[model samples]
Target: MMRSILERASHWLALVCRVIAGVALIAMLGVTIVDVATRYLDRLSDGAVAVTLLGSVELVSYLMLCSLLAAMAANVEKSQVVVEAFSHGLSPGFKHRLQGVYLLGFAALGLILCLGLVDSAAAAARHGEVTQDLRLPMGPIYTTAAVLSLLLGVRALIHALLGALFGAEGEVSHGE
Candidate 1:
């Protein structure tokens, strides 16, 4: 019963993350298109309007970061990468153990990244850091990214535990 609840929760969380990432990606694409179009228009008009999107670079950077962080949990859940070359001849049991170890290591790395991001966010908050043009506070963005990193760590740890206990067959489905 508990496992089922956890599985459902994880699936829902992954779906949310994927959706957020997709939105961020679309926003970035739109922003880039507008920026480019405006630049072209400015050139065509010989600087008559001098139109340019303010803080576009900063906004896109933040959006890209958010998208990457948000997608990470889903990617980890899906095991998106497959490197069969190294483990081609390995037995299924051995491969499962190896995968478990890899997932645990990834969890540890995520934890470290989350801690560092938290510290960075705190420092940004304390220093009143802001982007050059938009004066947008970076503390919130960093904090959000840190939270996503923590979620990724939790997901990795869960996968590691499941793999260790039940081999490759014990996967938590993300509702297909």
Candidate 2:
């Protein structure tokens, strides 16, 4: 029962990430449009257009990075990376053991990244950093991204372990 719930949750989370990615793409498009409009307005006004364009650039760049992260996380969940060399002539047991090792290493790396990002974000927040023009606070975004990355990394490790233990290559569905 718990396994089923985890599987379902993973699927739902992937779907949500896909949706957010799509929305972020749309927002980036909108930002481009706004930048264009502001350029035209700049010809009439003194320099208000420059400010708006800069703000849009900053906001859109950050959003697009977030979207890319979402999509990349989904790819990791799907096990979409190529592992061609390891595919040849390995026994089932060996393959499973190798996968387990890879997952544990990856989990450790992800934990380190999560900790570093959290520390960086906290330091930035303490300094009261703000983006130019928009003056947007980046603390929340940094923290959220770090947390999500951590969660996704942990999930990936768990799924990899589960598959290595009880699942065959064809039997496990990695949110495909």
Candidate 3:
């Protein structure tokens, strides 16, 4: 029962992350289009109607970061790149073990990255770092990124455990 509940929660979390990523992507596209249109209008009007959105670059950068970070969990869960070239001839059990080891390694790497991000975020907060154009605080953004990284590490670790216990073939399914 507990495992079932945890699985459900994981599914919902992955879904939410994917949804957030999609929203961020759409927002970034809209902002970029508006910024470009404003630039074009400014040129046509000979600077008479200056309408460029301030801090657009900063906004876009934040949106890109959000999109990338938000999508990471879903990507790790569902979009793992498969390369059959190297393991084509391996037996199923061997392949599963290999994949389990690889996933554990990936989880370790993610943990390291998460730690680095945490340190970076603390430094940014201490230094009062902010975006140049918008003066947006960099600390919160870095902290959020660190949270996402931590989530990715947890997800990868879960996947590794599943693979190890049940074989890669018995790992979590997409269900679609």
In terms of lDDT, which candidate is strongest? 1
Candidate 1 lDDT score relative to the true structure: 0.78
Top candidate (TM-score): 1
lDDT of 2 by residue, 64-153 (tens): 877876665554445545375855677665665566556666567657777887987898799987777688777877886776577557
Better candidate by TM-score, 1 or 2: 1
| Total clashing pairs for each candidate | 0, 0, 0
Q: Which ranking of candidates, highest TM-score first?
A: 1, 3, 2
CA-lDDT, candidates in order: 0.78, 0.67, 0.74
Of models 1 and 3, which has the larger lDDT? 1
TM-score to true structure, per model: 0.85, 0.74, 0.84
What root-mean-square deviation over C-alphas does model 3 reach? Answer: 2.7
Could you give candidate 1's per-residue lDDT for residues 81-135 as a string of tens digits? 5478887898776666567677897788778889999999999999999877899
